[model samples]
Structures are given as structure tokens and as C-alpha cells.
Target chain A: MHEAITEEKWDIVIEPRSSLLSINWKEIWHYKDLLMLLVKRDFVAFYKQTILGPLWFFIQPLLTTAMYFLIFNKVANLTTDEVPPLLFYMAGVTCWNYFSETLTKTSDTFITNASIFGKVYFPRLVIPLSIVLSNLIRLAIQFSLFLLFWFYHLFVTGKISPHWELIWLFPFLIVLMAALGLGLGIIFSSLTTKYRDLRFLLTFGIQLLMFATPVVYPLSLASEKYKWLIAINPFTGIIETFRYIFLGKGDFNWIYLGYSCGTTVLILFAGIIIFNRVEKTFMDTV
Target chain B: MSGNAIEIRNLSKMYRLGEVGTGTLSHDLKRWWYKTRGKEDPFLKLGQENKRDTAGGDYVWALKDVSFDVKQGEVLGIIGKNGAGKSTLLKLLSRVTAPTTGTLKAKGRIASLLEVGTGFHPELTGRENIFLNGAILGMTKEEIKRKFDEIVDFAGVERYIDTPVKRYSSGMYVRLAFGVAAHLESEILIVDEVLAVGDAEFQDKCLGKMHDISSKEGRTVLFVSHNLAAIDRLCSKALLINRGKVVMENTPKKVIEEYSLTNYIPGEIIFEDNRFLKFLSLKQEGNNLKIVCDYDAPTPLEIPCLGFVISDSMGNKIFGTNPNYQPPKTPIKESAKGRLQIEILYPKLLNGRYNLSIWFGDGKVDYVVMENVLSIEIINMINYVRETYATASGPVSPIVEWKYDYKD
Candidate 1:
């Protein structure tokens, strides 16, 4: 029997609320341990029974890059602008995989997590944040493999030159891809709670978006009329900036990069607003 | 108001009836239009009372204007029939879902155990699931670590702590889950029928733990359960909710008595064939139960036997009585229809629901037999013992005289 009767006052007031600025940062901060556990669960539970386990992380991008090289470079004869086919396609594949994987996983947050969310009262944003963080770990592993190939090309062929612009461009491109993926993922997830048909459209839409990006071909190959069409895609600036900084082969423009950053911020805020609104009442409909 | 731990004011929750897909878009548009023009949403006014059997309108209020105050250290039992908004009330208190209208002011950290193993991942080990489940119930990592050994000891699963929960038996799983939940340190604990899991021994242990938490620690507890015996032993006050409304709030004994009297119906059946007896009404007055009927006899009968059987809710016969055991003082006359009332005193039945059936026959041939003609409920009012072992061996609990002789 441990009884301490103090006259401390801590009142919790609950009411019907529709406030756009009700995101409790302090509450989220308090549940940081739960968020870390969720991130660990996501990473560990994914490859529990698989024989290769985390080796699949490296193998996936390796196989995808090889297929892209064979199809685009050999069959379609796409140009890489003096960059080696291995380094060119691997850079694009590694960066795009992080973005697409984060987006796909985060977009299915409400559907895949209805059981946990319906029962508990933790901050709903923790699930998506864990998805993004877990995917970051996978991206780091694959990026190391890409650097292994980069060193091989550097020592054997001497065909690639690393640029000083990479000092700022590399981290900036990674953040841009993460923010963009998270933003769009939450937006689509909020909408998918009401309309499940959108989930079907998202898979094919991501596939089509890769062709619009500069993943297989350099941005310089697009004609002047179609270059704006490709530039409007935020990934174009990120992928092109990645290739230019790492391999020093593609063109990069500050204005297009700034545009992509601005769009990322806008979508992130919009996604947060929509996500906050949906998290409160989504249990009713879902 | 100052000493209250929870104060609910005019709380209500409205849900649309069916198919939340295509029709919701139009309703959303209409609601938005109403908001733009400074008008209330018309659908809110169309809500009916929540009766699952009846289909009436597009909207129903699961809880309607429920207001109550719980004292700082009182144990409150919420008793209700099915679909009586008990779970809805718990959900609102736990913040699982927001109310459509009204407000609740609660003082202290409210930990709700609405279900066992809420966030347990099958792929994770039992140790990891304890942390995960604890965190989901609003406990921090440090708190779980502090009670880690105690939880393992309580669950009696020390040998399988590192094994995946998927590999554990169902009994082990529930034990682990309840062990984690039992250690939650909150000022207010809200539980909803979670004790229905686990074995009888474990359930008794959980009841004792809940009693200790409330009485010893001076914490407020709100428990919703269908086990009237547990409610009688643990709760000081009870609230009876019917059709999404609070009907009564009083001491547990009085409220349970009123609830049983109003909730269950004592059935009646009339025999039109006129071969034997016609049933009238079966009612209970205090510990005395009386069954009234009419016996119409054509010819003079030497010996007519009449009996009534009592069975528990599961259709198991607890006990029965007949006039053949002891003859009546007076016999009925020939060609007379007379009202007969059979009164039994101090039957000493346990606290549970039961159904009554009546039978009539002469010494030579059987005349009439009715199965489950009436249903009645028996509640323990005078006996306040915490532990009653009679519920395990059989259903009937008759008070027999005891005589002890010392041989010294």
C-alpha cells in the first residue's frame, strides 16, 4: 500500500474539437520510446523468417539496377552522358528505392495498422515516422553497396569524378526525397481511409512516375519542350542533382532544386494538416 | 465537484446507421453547405435511441446525454444489458474515440484496459511484447523495467520469457497480458470485462488485485462487467444503464436488485386444452418466490401431484420440488377452478439467472408439462462474503444447519 495524497492539480479536458493546430508536440515527445520500439519492430519483423534476412536490402537494388541497365542502356539505348552504366543506374535506383518504398509503406499506414490504432491511443504519426526511419536504415545499407561500386569504377576505370557540390547536394537530396515521400504518403493514406480504390491506383502511379523522373536517362536528353514537363516533377531535380554531385555527369540547376524544396515544404504541411484531421475521426469510417 | 475524479457532462455519441461509403459524400457536402450558411447539421436532429433490434432511421445515438461524477477513491461498477452503451462510454473515457458533443473533465492519469494484448506482435518475444503492451497502455519504458521481474513472476512464464508469443499457449498468453496490465500505476483505472479471460484461479487473483488497488492504494476504479457476483464483492456503488441512459445509481446491492427486477420478464402461459392447469404469473418477493396458476378439475381426484423445476441459464436443473414429497393440508373439491399459489420460502439460491417450469399430474397419469415457462433472477443481498465456493460445485446454495461436537 503506497499512498501519497498530494493536492496537485492536473486536469484533462476532453471535448468535441475541430482545431487545425491541435498537434501536441509535447505528447509526441513523451512517447518517443514507443516510437523507437515501433521502428525496431518494423525492421525486425519484416525479415523474421526469410533465409537472407537483411541481405535482401542490398540484393533488391542490385537486381533492379541490373534490369534497368539491360533494358534502358542495351535495349532502349538510353544515354547516361559519359557516366558508367553501373554507377549511373545504381545511384538512380538506390535513391529512388528509398523514396518509393517510404511512400508505399507510409501510404498504407491506416489500412495496415487499423488493429493497433483502433485499440491504443498513442500518437498516430509515430507509425508513419517509424516507416520513414526504418526505410532510412535500408537506404543506408544500399548506399554503402553503391559506394563499393563507386570505388571500383574510380580505381579501375577512372571515368568518374566526384564533385565538391556533393558536400551540400547529397544530404539536401536525401532530405528532399524523404520529405516528399512522407508528405505524399500521408496525403494518400488519409484519402485511402475513405476510398480503398486509390490504393490500387498508387502502385501503377509510382511505376509511371519513375519514367517521368530522370532515373534511367539523363535530364539533358529531354527536348526543350518536354524538359519543363519533366522538370515539374520534383524527383527530376533530386535524381539529377544526385547524379551530378556523385558522378559529375548530369546537369543541376538551383532554381529547379529550390522549386522542389518549396513543393516539399508545401506538401509536408498539407499532409500534416490532412493527417491530423483524419487521425481523429478515421476510426469511425475505417 | 472539487473531490470528484471524473465529471461527465451531457456526453453523447452519434453514429450513422449503415453503409458509410457512397452516401457519406453527399452527407458531407450537405453538412459543409449547412456550415457555410450558419445552420446546424440537420442529421444530428434525426438520431434515434440505440436499439440494435429495431431499424428506424439513418442515425442513432449510442450514448445520450450521459452525466455522472465519480468520487476520488470510489469503485464504481457499470452494469448494463448488451448494446447499452457500456463500451461506448469506456471508449470515450479512454479517448479511443471523440464524442460528438459534450465534455469530460478528469483529474489524474486514466489508464484503461479495454482489451488484453492490445498491441502484442506475434513475431516478437514475450519480453518484447510486455514492453510494447505496457507502452500502449500509457506506461513508460522505465516503469515497465522496474516491474519486469514481478510481471514475469506473476504470469508464471519465466521459462518462456524469451520465446515468441506466437509459440505460447492461449492460457500463457492471457496470463502474460494480464500480468503486464496489473502493474499499471495510474490514479484512475478503467476496465471493461477483461477479467472474463484467464482461468477461475487467475480471475479470482485479478479480482483480489483490483480490490487491493482500489482499497489499499486509494485509487479510483470504474469497472464494467456482467459478473454480478464480482460486482457485488468489489464495487461500492453501481450504475445501471439501459438503452444508452443511466437508469439508476446507488449502492451495488440495491441497484442490482432494481436491475434484475426491471430487466428480466417472468413469462406466463395459458393452457387452452383444459386437460390440466393454466399458468398465471411467477414473481419473486424478497427471498420468497411465488408461482400462481389455476387448476380446473372435472372429476374428484384422490391425489394430484404438482411440482415446479428450476434451471440455471444454461438449462441445467439445479433443483425442483413436488407435493409428493409432502402432502398438502387440504385437497381441492370436484368440478372447481381455483387459483393456486405456490409459495416457497428461503430457497437459498445462488446469485444468478434461472428459468422455472411447472408440471402437473395425477398419481396414475401425467396431465400437463411446460418447459421454461418463466424466467427469474436471484441476487445476493444479505450475504456480503468476498469468497463463495458454492458457485463451483453446483448451482443450488441451501443454508443447512451445522452441528459441531467437541470430543474433549
Candidate 2:
């Protein structure tokens, strides 16, 4: 009994720093219930006071798709690879909205939740992770709307032919976009704690980043020399590969999809490292 | 559970002195450069003590080599002046921020109540927020469900449990938030002045809950508060910290007595390093009380009035004096800076303990005031005639002239 006391076995030993790459995944797993609850908080409260409520989830992409079709397709005459204009714009809108909304909201994690972070102790990663999940729910609603239009066009017009064999790559692409957003978002959130001007830059930078992605214009329409530049964007391969699988007339394929996956892993890994360093002391700096 | 619940060794937290933007990037770059070169932090050597009002270097050590240990089930009361690093210590223990140096080893979950209602959303109803805040403080959903009714009953906001917290009055909101935190099940609890809120009755209820958490449940607790009575009543042991260091650790009564004496050291009185009066002393000789004060002044009458009050143990003013009523050669203002002192002789006072507080003013406004600067106790006293008074009848006992005439 005396030997079994295990006097030195402490459940938690906190120090000034931990290794940059070392993550306490088990500790985070312990707080999964908190993660789910926070996800509910974020997703449910987003449109709480609105008239239409969660229906706005479907309404938002519909409105954005119509607006983009008017400005980009009807006025500018940009091609959507000959897919029905509304369906084409809706797909891009749904996919891009997930990435952009998740990135923008998750990047404000530190600043927006400083009060909570300063007061209580939980897995700091829970916040950005919850944001990702909440945005995924929004994306799911918008994706169904897009899928409704796609099914209508596939059966009625019979003009668009989807590559059914490549359909397995669907959920993987959503995950890639989510990972990329979470990674970059946490990094920016960690950084903006010190340099507040990054916030102002990020608000517009995400907007400009949409044009960089092939959201409105097809990757095929990009000029020869600068096409490589657009391809450099991780989202380019993702959005293009998404269109190629469903719309069946895209220029990108599996190689670009692989490249996007690699980029997601790299950015997400770096983002976690930065976030781990920042979360401990962001309360003071913020 | 029989061993130490928490052990902190040389914990310290350093903070930058000024605003975070602009020069911070360069400092970060420089620190990164040093880290790359495998050198110690460059600015680590430059910080001074955490004296808030004083101008110091660009860095300050908020908690400097603070080390303490708590046995399982021991309730330790932390008493300190503001900015004395009590909050920093609690923050480190709660893992709110990592320390700049040193290690903290603790067993089991530790929940810290730095502020009540820490993540409570205004839009969340009282019931929803109970679940949300319970989860935030490390309670699972099932645990919150079990305690939900108890928390509501404790807060006595049962009628408005479904109402959004934004609609509750300030007192009601504080009560509800505190009720949620009080129910959190953890091995160790760190509370920081959270009982200072709510009405007095609710504060007592919170204190009672805290007492039960430590004594009845056998959990370790670290309580920080300025209320000495609460500390004395609740804590099994008390610690006094000053200037980011542990000044004393002893029984609550002795530690509190020593803490009160920090403002008035024997034979000298200095608060904030004698910012107002350079020297102050009160003494009793025979039947007279001697009050001497010295302060800095550029010219005579810059400080026109100086006085002290003698209050009973209950803080009721028994007697006081100032130079306003009488004129003296070489006025108090002219006699400041060590030239003169005031000595007053009155009829012998009753035997009782009294407190002496001093103040300096310019006849219109007080420049500085400090309480508990001196405490005087009078014992047996012989008046003009040889009559011994063992105890006090009134603040002052005076000899009265009497004749043989009886109601004539």
C-alpha cells in the first residue's frame, strides 16, 4: 500500500512551453461534448432572430447564385462549362461559401472568444473545430439546394453529364476545403492577436481570394500564361476538380485534387502549431 | 488523494509593460532570433517587480518564483494587496496561461472561478446557459442535468429559469451565474473574489457553498479575497503575499494580524512607502497621548491641517482633534517637515482597546488618509486620586469635583 501511493504521478503538469508539434489529442477528445454543444451554439444562433430561420440556409445560396449568374454569366458572358447557369453558379456558390465562411469566422476565434478563454480552461482548439463543424452544416443545407438544381438539369435538360465513376471524390473535396479553411483561419486568428491590421486585410482578402478561385469563371477560361498562377491557389484544384466531377467539362482531374489534399495537410499542420503557441497567452496580447 | 493535490515550483509569469502593437513585432523577431541561436530569452533578464503604480522596465514579472503546495482537501486562503500576483498564480494553476518559467503539477481536474458568468451568452436562456456554462467549466451534460434543479433552487430564479439571461436584473444574473459555477464538480477549486458580487445574503450562500465544497466534500480549494473575515472564517490556513512573493504563511489569525501590521510597522507608519507623511507615530505616556507627524512641503501652509482619530474596536469614532479650533505659534503647516509635533493631555480615559487613524489635509481637502495606522490599549490607570480602573466605562474617564451638598 505504501509503495502504491504513486506520489509523483500527477494528472496534469503544466510548463512554460510544450513542443510545437506535440498536440494533446486525447485531452481534446475528452471535451468532444463541449465541441458539439458549441457547434450547436454557433450554427443555431446564427439566424436566430431572422424571419425565415434555418430556411435562410437554403435561401442564402439561392440569392447569391442568382446574383452571380446575373453579374458574371448573363452580363459578363463567362462560361460555366455549358452546365445550366443556375446549377453551375449554385455549385460554386455552395462550395466557395463553405470555405470562405468557415475561414472568415474561424479566423476571429481568438478575438471574439477572448472573454471566455480568459476565464475558463478547456481545449482551446474546441472553438475553431466547432466553427468548422457549424459551417459544414450550413454547407450541407446549401449543397442540397445545389443538388436539387443539378438533378433537375440532369433529368430535364439532359445537357450536363456527370462522371458517376468519380463521384466518390465528393465528400473528400468538402473535407479538403474545410481543412484548408481551418488551418489558414487558425493561423490568421493567432497572428491577428498581435497585428490587428491583419483583420482589415483578411476581410477583403477573402473576397479577392474568391476571384482567384474558379468560382465564377471556368479554369479553362484562364489565359495560358497566368493559368499556372491560378493553379497555384490550393482552392483552384479543389473547385475545378469539383466542377469536372459533376459538370464533366472541367480541365482539372485527380492530380490537381491530390495537390490540393497535400496543401491542406501542410497548411493545417502549420496552423495547429501556430494556434497552440498563441492560445496559451493570447488573452494578454489580445 | 492523501498526497499533495497541487505543487507549484518557481512559477513566474512575465508580461510586456505597454500596449501590444507596433514594437511587439520587433521584440518577437528578436526573441525568435535568440531562440534560433539557442540562447535564453533576451528580455527575461530585464523585468522588475510587479509594482503597479511605479514606472519600471519594459517588462515585469507578474509572479516571480512563486512556489507553494496544497495538500489534498486543504483549503488555503490567499490574502494580498491588489496586483500582488494572486490572480496570476490562480491563472497558472487553472491553465488559463502558461507560466513564463517553472512547473505546476496537479492531480485531477481544477476549475477556477476568476469571474462568474464567464461564457454566459446574453441571448441564452437561464436553462440553456446552465448547460452551456456547465460544459464550459468542465461538467458533462448529464452532471449538469442532475444539478440543474439544484442550481435553479439555489439561485431562486426558478420562475425565470426559461427566460433569457439578458432579461434578468443584474443581481438575478449574478446569482444565476454563480449558482451554475458553484455546482461544478472538480477536485480543486480556485475562486477569486467571486463572492464579492450578488447581494449580501447571496454572497453568504456562496461562501457557505464554498465552505461545504472544501470541508464536506474534502476537495482542495484556493480562495482569494480582500474580505479578511471570510478568509479567517473559511480558510484552514492563510497565506499573505506582497510584491509577487509569499510574505507569510501561518494560521489565519496570526497571518491576518501580521498582514494588518504591514501598513503600520512598530514605531513607524508607512503606507505606499510614505507617499504623504514621512514619519508618523502615536505614543502614550502617563495620561497623555503623543502624536508626531512629518511630511514634505515646499512652503508653510501648503498643508494646513493634520489630525488623527481614535476609534473603538467597532470603528466608532471615540475622540478626534485638529488644529482648526485653536491657533498656535508656528502653525502646523509652518512646523511640518520634522520641526514640530502635537502632544495632547486629557483626563485619563477608560481602559479599552482603540484604533488610531491619521489624515493629512490642506484645511479644505484631504491629501492622504490611512486607517489602522495605530492601535492603543489602556489598562489600569490612576487618576488625580489613587483609583484604579481595570476596565473601560467610557472612552475617557475624567475626575469630577464633588461637594457634600446633596440635592440642595
Candidate 3:
């Protein structure tokens, strides 16, 4: 056993690396258990003291849907492509919450985990990735509530119908949302570590982004002159395509879906590059 | 397969001083501009040594081109005064922050206990925190499971294992944190003054555990601490750092001796606020100690006192003497230079370092009070008690008369 130990070579060599592409994928894979435990911690810690516990997960999107229904559909007279207003708003709220929650939580990964990061050495990417995964659990719960309302409207009113497009399009839309959220979250997190100005801008910026996306109002209600303005948002394609797939009333544009996918991949790549670079030396500044 | 477990080559870390945000943007922009033109960073040359006393530069090198090697299973102690780059070296070794310019090649995993219980969440139960802390220390779930019972038992918190750590007392919290860190299976362990916290018993327990890890388990350990006795007991090899540079690397005894001597500031003006009395020298001659000072009395006083205090290395006062009780024969008057010498019989103190504080004043008004003016190393010149071993049982060894009466 002693001879065997002596024969083994060095396992790790630390150095001042200059390359932005020196991400250690194998080490991340090696620490997959840590990533999962972090996800579990986030999920459990979020509602540890709440009286309602996981019920808040469902109640949050439900209350938001009600508020949106009252303000946008009833007051502003916004259209929902002939679908039931509750179903429309619930669908939008569920999908939009998943993206926004993931983005907001993951964006604070470095700041929130600074104590842990400073004391230990693990793949820092594990933190943002865990945030993305944990938010998915909340999204899943909220999505179930949306599905319950959708099925009720389907049978009782016969106003909305399911589309075959959802079989492939639904998963694609979810992936797109997850990627975009994780991407933008890490990019802003990396920048915020050096200059905290971006942290203050992110809260209001995400709120404005929600309005820019087709969440409360249907894409078909957008005027032709302002349609491109909405289309410019990467989230617009995903949310609009999600409504189109589930309700079969909103327009489905393959070109827009393709554009959203491309943007997701681009942002995700850039975010990882920046995140990798920042993780190495963030302890110095942070 | 080399014997060296860690080889550090020209390791350095530079930190920008003051507001890092406002000035960083412009510096970054300028760096980028320079990089585009294929020139070296313009600001790299301005970094000075990290000296807390003087501020002259915008950047300081916390660790300046330090290179060292640690053989396998060596217990290396890093000793330095505050702001001496000891913690910064450990930080760089732990990869908490990357080096500014250097390379470190190491064999096997490294675990750094910079502080105990680094990632403990107060909301989590003791059992849950064990898993969390274990995972943060790079243990997998299966490994944590294997060591779960052992960790709880070692921490001696089995009764409250399922309760949240917030409810645990601070001692229990440190115990649990230390238990998790002690069970880490990393080959190289970096500890930074963690034993300074917790109680004396627990600190001794940790020192014992570190000894076991380095000797029996053959794990390489780098420990940094201000406790010289602890370093002397635990480390075979020690490194002394000063002003972000390694001043000496030698055996622990020699390094600690050199450290204490170098830290001693002799023939230096410790204080000069009033300047009514100026201390000259404190010298030890055989069994007698002499304190020389220059006294300048602004006005004649009824009783002027000259006093001195002697304290051990840990700053515990052993004894003090003042002439006020006996009263001096003459009063002092103002003069450009008036030398005064006071000699007292040195106590039969044990072999150790002691600090002397000198003061000269009238009965009520104080003229000068200089703290820690001189540090003297006492050596046992004669074994009067016939005891070869020098154990400091008390502050002073006094001869007491012994009387024995015959009893049936």
C-alpha cells in the first residue's frame, strides 16, 4: 500500500492562469454531489420558517396571477387571444416566475455565498447551477397549479384546446428559459462582484424586462409597428411560443424560436467565460 | 513521486489600497488600453511592501515573491507579527485567492481550515450542518455518511445532533466545526490560528489532533499562529515572515528565539509626549539590574519617584518597584542633561523573556511613562535550588526558612 501511494503522481497543480478557457469540467463533475446538496439546502432553507411551507410556492404565482388578472385584464382591457383570463395569466405567471426567480437568485450567488467561497475551494459554478436547479422545483410546483387551471378550463368551458406543438415545444421553451436565466444571472453576478452598481440595477431591470416580455398581454395584441420591439426581447419568443404551444391560439414563429435559442446559447457561453474568470480572483475584491 | 508535497515558486499577491471601486474602473480601462498596445501593466511597478505604519503607495504586495517547499508529512509553522503576510500566504496556498504572479505545484488534495465551521448555516440542524460543512470541505455524500457517527461522537454533541446549530452554545458550535475539519481526508491541511478560538482544553485537543495528523497519518500541514509556545511544541520546521517577506526558515526553537529577539526594540524611544524624562538603557549585570534615564524636572518637587515594572512574555506583571515608598534623598531641577541610575537586585525568575516599563514622576503629577521599554531574556546562571529543570512555578523564587519539630 505504501509503495502504491508513493507511485501516484500529483493530482492538482495551482498556478496563475491567464486563459479564459481554462475551466475545469472534470473537477465540476467530481463535485456533483456538492452541487446537489447545495440545491437541497436552497430548497429547504427557503421555506424553513414559513407557516405554509411549500404551499407558498403555489400561493405565490396564484396571488400574482390574480393581481395581474385584476390590473391588466380587467383594468387595462388587455387581450389574451380568446383564452380564459385566469388560465392565460396563470400560464404566463408560472413561466415568467421560473425565469425571473432563477435569474434573480442566481445573480446573487457570489454575494450570498461569499462566506463559504472565501473559506473553501469548490467549483464556484456549482453555486449558480444549484440556484437554477432549486428554482426549478418552485417552477414545477407553480406549473402544476397552472396545469390544474388549464385542464379545468379545457373540460368545463371548451374554450381552450391543447396543441400537438407542445409535445416538442414545451420542453424546448423550458430549456430556453433556464438557459437564459442562468446565463444572464451569472453575467450580472460576475460584474457585480467588482462594481456593486450592477446589483442595484438588476432588481428594477428585471421588473422592466417582465413588461417587455409577452407575459400579461398577448403577442397578437401588440401593434405591427411595436411588434419588433417586443420581439427583440429573448424572453418574448419563449413566452409567446409557450402560450402558442399550450393554448394553440397565439402565433408560432419558428424563426423567432430559433433566434431565442441562439441568444440563449450565446449568453450562456459568455456568462460561463466571465464567471470562470471572476471566480478565480473574486475573493480579493469581494 | 518526489518527496516534496508542496512547491511554491515566486508566489506574490498585490492588493490595491483604499476605495477599490471608484479608482478600479479607470485603472482597468488604462490596463486594457495598455494591453491593446502590447505593453506591461503600468501600475504593477508601484506596489510597495505591506507596512501598516506607513502609507506611501496605492498598492501593497501582501506576499512578495515567496518561494518555499514542504516535504511530505512536514508540519511547518508560519510565525509573524500582525500584517506580516502569514495569513496571506495561507490564503494563497488554499486558493481562496489566486496569486498575482507565481505557481504552486502540490500533490493531492488540500484542505484549509482558515476558520472553524466556515459554511455552517444556523438554520440547519447539527446533523444537517455536518453534511453541509463536510460537502464544503470537499467530502462527497458517501464519505460524509461514512464519517457521520464518528464526527458526532468526536464533537460530543450527539444529544443535540438533530437540533439546529443556532441553539448550540458557542463552545459546542466550535467543537462541531472543528470535528468536521479534523476528519477531513485531505493530504495537505492548512490551518490559520483556528486554535486561538474556543477554550483552552479544546485548543489543546486541536493541537493534539494536528500532531496526530502530521505524524501518524503523514499529512502535510501548514499552521500559522501568534502563539509561540504552541508553535514550539507542534512544529519541527518554522518560517518567520516580516514585511511580506520570509526573514528566516529554520528549526522552530531557533526561529522562535530569533523572532522574539528581532521583535524586541532596544535603544528606541517608546514614548515622548512630555519628554520630562528620557530613558537611556536597561542592562542586566549578573544578579543586579540597572535602569539609566535622563531626568529634566521643570520645577522642584517634594518627592520624585522612579519606578519600573517587569512582566512576562504574555504581559502578566510579575512585580513592580517604586521609590515613592522609601522616598528619594534629593529633588530634581530642570537641566539639559541630568543622568539618573537605579540598580535593584534581580529576582530569581525562571528562564524566560520579560518586558520592562520605566516611569519617572513626582508624587502626583506624571512626567513620563514608557510601556514595554525593554525586553530582557533571563538565563539561569546558577542552580542554587539544585533543580536543573527551569519550570516557572511562580513569578519569583524566594528562599523561605524551614523549621522542623520532632513529633512522636
lDDT of 2: 0.82
Cα lDDT, model 3, residue A16: 68
lDDT tens per residue, model 3, A7-74: 54667677766577678889888788888888888877888999998888878888999999999989
Worst 10 residues of 2 chain A by lDDT: A40-49
Return the TM-score for each candidate structure. 0.86, 0.85, 0.88
Provide a comma-separated list of chain B TM-scores, one per candidate.
Answer: 0.79, 0.74, 0.80
In candidate 2, which residue pairs clash? Answer: none
Clashes of 2: 0
Candidate 2, residue B288: CA error in Å?
Answer: 16
lDDT of 2 by residue, B209-288 (tens): 99999889999999998666678778999988888888888988788677655642243554446545677776655667
On DockQ, the leading prediction is 3
User: Which candidate number has the best lDDT?
Assistant: 1
Candidate with maximal TM-score: 3
DockQ of 3: 0.72
- Candidate 2: misplaced stretches above 4 Å? A4-7, B264-408
Q: Quality of candidate 1's docking, in CAPRI categories?
A: medium
